[model samples]
Target: MADASLFEVDTDELRRVGNTMVGIGDDVAEVARTAPMDGRGEWGHQGLAGAGDRFGARYRYLIEQLAEDVDRGGVSLRGSANAYEEMDAINAASIAGLGMDW
Candidate 1:
């Protein structure tokens, strides 16, 4: 159902929304990857953006929230950076693959 919506929305708009979401996610991932354990939450763009259309505006929050939880002792950071990087790479590719003219 969700994937269907992603493919069905107005392409230009969805591309814009998706690209922005991915950018935010990427930025959070980079910051979280290098951030000190305590400073990880500073990169809160994703969580802060989690109120709107989730997949549209709140998509990045999933990544941000994870970083926050990890910093709060909810998860280990040993391989966190790799995970975040993978997420960014995957999302960026998805956005670019759309070949949005905008």
Candidate 2:
């Protein structure tokens, strides 16, 4: 089997990536909320205008969903990093209680 020791967690990188994800999500949400839907009025035909409105509404909905998903992922990533740190601390305390030294 490959050495498990080769696997390592880069908590700082995880946090940075999480922050970036959150920022991107916020930006996307802002754009989705502010984007003009009035362009549908410019369509020449009534059918085209209605289709455009439907498409625009669906696009906004999808964007909102994406923003929510990304925000949740960012929170999970950051929380995972913190959990890792807490686990390490508990492990250290256990080792000390057992009179072990690293």
Candidate 3:
């Protein structure tokens, strides 16, 4: 296996991926909110319209859930990038201290 120390986090790439996810989530949310649905009417059309309403509601719910999940994933990725940087700094400080004979 390769040495773990050689592993490096590309924070700029991570941030770009995260931003992309966020944009996708936003687009999904917007589409879900704005998409047109069938209208209600008398006779058989009413039943079909009712069914369509139910299906549309479920669809919107699912889309919103996916959007939320994707947005959270993006936020988590960005947070991880920041955490890795902080850990790297701590490691460097610790290594520097070890070299000090005091």
Local accuracy of candidate 1 as per-residue lDDT tens digits, 1-102: 123233233334434454555555556666645423333335477564443334432445566776455443322232333354455557667877898521
Which lDDT values do the candidates have, in the order given? Answer: 0.46, 0.77, 0.74
The segments of candidate 1 whose C-alpha lies over 4 angstroms from its true place after superposition are: 1-9, 37-102
Q: What lDDT is reached at residue 23 by model 3?
A: 89
Model 2 agreement with the true structure over 7-95: per-residue lDDT tens digits? 25777777888999999889889878965567777778999898878878898999999999999899888887787766666766887
TM-score per candidate: 0.28, 0.83, 0.82
Q: Would you give me the overall lDDT of model 2?
A: 0.77
| Residue 77 lDDT, candidate 3, scale 0-100 | 82
Model 2 lDDT, residue 63, Cα: 91
Model 1, C-alpha of 24: deviation from truth (Å): 0.8
Model 2 misses residue 88 by how many Å?
Answer: 0.4
What TM-score would you give candidate 3 relative to the actual structure? 0.82
Model 2: number of clashes? 0
Candidate 2: residue pairs that collide: none
Q: Which candidate comes out best when scored by lDDT?
A: 2
- Comparing 1 with 2 on lDDT, the higher-scoring candidate is 2
